[model samples]
Target: MPRTREPFWRRLLAGTLPLLVWSLHFAFAYGLAAAQCTPAGMRPGGPDRALLGAVTLAAIGACAWLAWRAREVPRREDAGLLDWARLVLAVLALVAVAWTGVPLLLVTGCA
Candidate 1:
């Protein structure tokens, strides 16, 4: 049986959401916090400890969910080879989120 043509947007969504969220989380949670705090003289702690913590947690959770969604992209008989690459990206995204989040825990802000 012939496979149906999947749309490019669908493929991009399936592959990139996790990475996108991870990047957003890293930039906003850490970079924004640091930038905000540095100017305001928050020093060792950026955008309020609670706010930073919440952002970090949210990022991790979102990335994990995205990774889960990516992992669900069907690896069965009709699965496209791109599915493998997306799954890998999902895993990498999860790692990126965790790696970026570690600074929030360890540094508590910018060092």
Candidate 2:
């Protein structure tokens, strides 16, 4: 039988996209707040709330997409360990994204 081909982007990140996006979210969320907390980080107005909000939404969207893609993978009894690994990794990545995002709801600023 002929082997099925995954999309180029899918093949590039595949099972690790959620974690990658989460890393980006973390950098933007905490990193931005931390920067704003500093005296020189800004002119004293405060961290950019709008910017952070946008970042949070984008991160969540990416993680949700990753999880959706993971669920699209077929679950066959005959599937091998590698196939299983991809699904599990994607799920784990989504979990990581969620855990990292909870703070966004409760903490929204440098204060």
Candidate 3:
């Protein structure tokens, strides 16, 4: 059976959504850390690790879902560059989110 063509906007979104999500995650994580780790009120611990973990997990989940959706494209003979890009971007985003989240787990506070 032939697949219906998706709109260009939709195709572009699926291809780059992962990177978008990753960028958001990166910004949020660092922003939160910086805001909470001020010298004025040097807390005993670092930023709110729990909240960071939750956001990281949510971002990872989003990336994983996107990657799963694009999984079949790699197996299709007619798949184009955008199709491959979608899968690659999703996987890259997933790894990036995980890697960024690691420091939150290890670092205590602004020490």
Q: What is the lDDT of residue 36 in candidate 3?
A: 83
- C-alpha TM-score for every candidate: 0.74, 0.66, 0.89
Against the true structure, candidate 3 reaches a TM-score of 0.89
lDDT, candidate 2, residue 53? 68
TM-score of 1: 0.74
How many clashes in each structure? 0, 0, 3
lDDT of each: 0.73, 0.67, 0.91
Please state the error at residue 37 of candidate 3 in Å. Answer: 0.6
Predicted candidate 1 versus true structure: per-residue lDDT over 10-106, tens digit per residue: 8878777777888888778767666766756666544566766788788778877766766666656766767776777778877887787776666
Q: Stretches of candidate 1 above 4 Å error? A: 1-5, 41-47, 72-75, 108-111
| lDDT by residue for model 2 (51-85), tens | 77677777777767766766745767665554565
RMSD of 3: 3.3
Top TM-score: which candidate number?
A: 3
In lDDT terms, how accurate is model 3?
0.91
Ranking of models by lDDT: 3, 1, 2
